[model samples]
Target: MLLKRLQPMMFQARRNYVELMFQVMGRALQAISDVDEPTREEVRALPEGFLFEMQVMPNGPKLIVEHTGDGKLHFHGDTAPRPVDLSIQFKHMAHAFLVLSFQEKTSVAFANDRMLVDGDVSYAVRMTRVLNRLESFILPKLVAQRAVKEYPADIHLPEKLMSSARIYLKVATQFVETVRA
Candidate 1:
């Protein structure tokens, strides 16, 4: 009886954490795309005006990033615009929590059938590359290993540290502004 009572609460907690992670990750992607040239290139590789969306199925937290005309990505928080060009939908909040928390690497989660991709799967591959790059930039090496399929190459420790600090600072500022709004 007690276990049953705790299940819903645990799921709710996971849901909330996933929601928060989506917001922070949305900002992190924004900051990284602004500063990381490789990420920009990946965005440009997608179809012009591409809207890449990540969300949980059956009404869950979401984040959208659109490839704009200027060849850059624009962050849209939890609100997807019309005609999302590509969407990655997690099967459940637990699935999102595992992947977002880095307990399951993205490819691993996908292989394990934790998500559904709507729209052009090739576009999803392109966005996955972007996600991998962003994860490598923002996460510590040890942690990043669990989050990305391949650790980033040609990353000097000192340079990566400095870049990570700047990106984190930007994400933090974005978080604060979000709270104040």
Candidate 2:
């Protein structure tokens, strides 16, 4: 009887955490995608209306961003209104949080069966590259190295400093936008 009484509360707590996870991730992705010119170019080059979704399992929270060929990403307030071109689904909240916290790399999570990919393989690969770029900008060099397949050899001190400054400012701006909306 006591277990049953606590079940709903536990579920609600989990739901809240998942929703927060998606919201934070959405802002971070927006920040990274907003400032990087190369990443913006890559997003623009994607097929029009391409939607990418990263979701937690069992119909909890999801973050959906679309590439509209306008050099900017459209982050959906709700779920993806249109069909998803590529979906990376985490097996559970734990797995999703692990990746979000940078304890597990995205590639490592996928390779270890912690995630499911549903869509075109080639497009997913491209999307992985884009995600890697974002991770590089946001994560420290040690963490980013684990998260990405390879670090760019040409990222020198001046460029790294500039990129870090832009990424930090963008993240702050996105946080404000998220809070305001």
Best-performing candidate as measured by TM-score: 1
lDDT of each: 0.86, 0.77
Score residue 91 of candidate 2 by CA lDDT.
Answer: 90
- Residues 20-127 of candidate 2: C-alpha lDDT, one tens digit per residue: 767655665666577678778777767878888988887858988887666577678447897888888999877876777678888889889999999988878877
State the lDDT of candidate 1 residue by residue for 41-153, as single tens digits.
87878777788889999899999888874447777998876778888999988899999999999999999999999998888888898888888878888999999999978
Show pairs that collide, candidate 2. none
Among the numbered candidates, top lDDT falls to 1
TM-score for each predicted model, relative to the true structure: 0.93, 0.81
What range of 10 consecutive residues in model 2 has the weakest lDDT sum?
23-32
